[model samples]
Target: MSDLLARHRAVMPNWLALYYDEPIEIVSGKGNRVVDASGKSYLDFFAGILTNMIGYDVPEVREAVERQLATGVVHTSTLYLMRGQIELAEKIARLSGIPDAKVFFTNSGTEANETALLLATYARRSDQVLAMRQSYHGRSFGAVGVTSNRAWKNSSLSPLNVHFLHGADRHLTPFRGMSDADYVAACVEDLRHVLSTVVGGDVATLIAEPIQGVGGFTMPPDGLFAAYREVLDAEGVLFISDEVQTGWGRTGSAFFGIQNHGVTPDMMTFAKGLGNGFAVGGVVARGDLMDGLHAVGLSTFGGNPVSMAAANATLDYVLDHDLQANAARTGALIVDGLREAAPRLPIVGDVRGKGLMFALDLVDPATGAPAPALAARFMEETRKAGLLAGKGGLYGNVLRMAPPLTLTVEEAAEGLGIIVDALETVNAEVTS
Candidate 1:
């Protein structure tokens, strides 16, 4: 482990964070569990940052990838027609919920957001964009520029004229004590104020995550985006849903997280789970905006046949098994379990999530302050107990939980019990 970590530090960026005091090197995964280099196994509650929507070692997805690999051509480069790519695009366009949607594929969520920004700016003939606070879009120059999460922003430079808004963080301040209806009203008013007074002119778009991922599964009330969308539409500003973490039924009740709001975004950017680990991502937008951008000579390796095959097969399994329903059922069971136990665990300051995506807001029990140290201890405890979780947030005190949508009820119970035990262990250690 030391040698591997030394090698990693030698080559990788210093800013990239790894979990645990001694990072576990995951060598292989199957179902919802992964094996470390030392042969210890962990039940993965984080799904590799929620990328593996289905699970690991899925036979259908693997066979599809193998079939595509056997085709003898790997780099079609979008210069030629490929049936898999075409079919996958059609499926995404239909699933996107944007009317007369057109699709463009990319290799990751960062590229997907970049494409969305380009399209929004080109269509509106403006560089101005609005993003959610306590949110993370991506790590690229433009994505980081639009992101409001300070921990992820390395530089102030950007290609777009960006503005930050009170998005999911309405749960944070100023609007905190208000009722749900009034909170939405307050945020809508905030949007109006920003557009009318702060932004220069003719804002291109507003991009947001239905639920903030790297910002620690933070989410707004049900109708927050719908309220914002009304104001944006009135001002000719397009709304883009960054579904990098919430897409493809991870949220349980809806096919896309945006659907939960009773509205549709003008454009949607997706990644993280579409290929179920095969590196596929994309944007779906209204035909007029997409055609207006032209986006000629877009990507060299985006939507390669191999990725499409994997994504198509992965999607098919999700649909065939009705994993959305499974996520809903199992997610509720786990969340209910957590809430029931939260009262006993004072370290759990807050328990929040939708479907499979959720967070345990760890806090100092004595002072009610964000406690990164306690969060770290809890994570280590969970690891020791054979569970792997994710962590992040503005204060780095939130523990993220997002198992595969394919999680079964029994698995959920096991993970929940492990979490309870970990919290108890950490609580005793801290109190002692």
Candidate 2:
């Protein structure tokens, strides 16, 4: 092992996962590329796990952070008024479509979701929560409780009682061959069954990601949540859209992934990409629900001026550049390119995602079983080709790609070509 690798192993916990057989430490980045400690450069297709929204070394964000630091008033706690915090909250509250919305800032997506769950349970007077299978929320105890993916969930010790419901993974579901209408109806019926038989009644809330990020960019049929929203409305259950990965126009089709489903959530939690790499996250909820936190509550570092400044600048950059439209256009090119190439590759099980987020699921050519080994080989080959990608899914066989929303058509083509080459190299090695 390298000296840095040895040092990292000694300092970090064993459960802390790192990518690749030999991990390279990233020293710096610009746009879609990052340079490692050894001066090697790689195209960053995963965009720091979809957190680097506008891309690396964004000038506006950098300047904003520098300006905040120059002020020398980074930490004033939530007790005192912070102009940056109030201004950022105003923007978020206005963007959040919920009527009479209010925003509560947090340090990360985990805290944001934790706060969302608290508001949900308190407002609805139920500790029970509904989540989707193959879903991942976060690593916190409260976040893990709702997480259904076994790979990431640490323990069963949780404050809230959680139930897992069927999320739309059409390829892996029994309804894969069914028509869209039929499949949605089936999932809705399953949800109804769970609500009635399992929970015995309405739960506090139903939380979901518009597109499953760590679950390999999994998507449900259109209007899936809208149907669920009808049930939630009837039962007076809150709908919490986990936009941690799907927010901020990354979905290309809409500003928020929930918009694709034709329903507005009662509450929405966001984190990734909002700060463009800064640790910024928050929840926007209806005024009544946000006010349900009866006792005194405040986050010490939730709305720090520095993070707020970074987020404000990042948001401004995203809007000024119209990166959302770019994401949609370039994402379409990448997906279409992969689909065209998929026919020749027997190991490719599926290519699915929205906007800039996508996944290429690998499987055994003969048996159609998830081919984790093949995915691993492809990942290594992609690294060799000067590309950085991510892998996820319950089986760990899905190659994930979520480049920055500002990705150009040429950059998308380059990444797609590298992926195609890597896939071919792995296929040849395995088939030989």
The lDDT per prediction is 0.89, 0.90
lDDT of 1 by residue, 1-432 (tens): 999999999999987889999998999999999999999999899988889889999999999999888988777888888899889889888888789999989999999999999999998999999998887889999999988878888899999888888867654668777888998888888889998898888999999999888888888888888888888888999999999889888889898998889879988999888898889889999998888855366588898889999999988898899888888899999889889999988788889888998889888888878999989998999999899999998899999999999998889999999998988888887767
Candidate 2, 256-297: lDDT as tens digits: 899999888999999989999999999999999999777999
lDDT (C-alpha) at residue 341 in model 2? 93
Q: Work out the TM-score per prediction.
A: 0.98, 0.98
Q: Which runs in model 1 stand beyond 4 Å of their true positions? A: 171-173
Error (Å) of candidate 2 at residue 198 is: 1.4
**Candidate 1 CA-lDDT value:** 0.89
Cα deviation of 72, candidate 2, in Å = 1.0
